[model samples]
Target: MSTTALIYEGDWVSGTSQLDEKFIGYVESMNRSGGLKVRVTQCDREDAVGTSVEAALAKVRKLPDYTPSAPEELKDLIELSLATHDKEWFDELSARLAAPQAAAEQDEEKRYRFTPYQSRLYRIAE
Candidate 1:
């Protein structure tokens, strides 16, 4: 069988691996706090970046009312918004969002990574 490649952080880690294999390898490289893995993977890429960001926001919204303590990258994203929009409003919203997200992370059940959906488009495009 021919192998399909999944690019991780624009680097080739495991070549010719199945989707699950590639995803497991990617998750292993992540830090447990702040959902940094999601932020980095979703926000960094050209192809899946926007979709990933949308997914992240949806995940965040689904969490219970808890606070996120260690959220440097998220803070930066909020700050970026403040730079463009209203600083005070964004700051308050950021704080509120941070708390629940932090609480959500404390749970053992939070699904962290983006699940890959298979498509024929990859083959068709090629």
Candidate 2:
């Protein structure tokens, strides 16, 4: 069976509430910062296991604002959480997140150096 893994970082809450001011703000921030990378693996199965990552995301979106962070259409998220705790899977996910930082450093090191303007009076003798 093919299985798709969608990886994202956040404490998924069941429902929206203002009672816990701190948690509400945190979750809202996560919702706004949508940089989470979802790596979907195509699984060969019929149930939720076979559902595409896109489908899983859609399900999450449909959840009511009051749903708790535990279940509430979080089957896919739960799977991701479990996978993240697995040594092998967590290592892979960590690598994926680190790639961009490494790439940025490499790009900085290879950046172009600006040359002085080729003005007639300021031209350097060859």
Clashing residue pairs for model 1: 66-99, 66-100, 67-99, 67-102, 68-98, 68-102
Q: Write the per-residue lDDT of candidate 1 for residues 3-122, one digit (tens) a residue.
A: 112222322122112211111112222222323133223322345432222111112221123344456756766777778887776777687767776777766354554346633335
lDDT of model number 1:
0.37
Candidate 2 lDDT by residue in tens digits, 61-81? 212234323332344444585
- Against the true structure, candidate 1 reaches a TM-score of 0.20
Best by lDDT: 1
Could you tell me every candidate's TM-score relative to the true structure? 0.20, 0.27
Which ranges in model 1 have alpha carbons more than 4 Å from their true place? 1-70, 86-96, 101-126
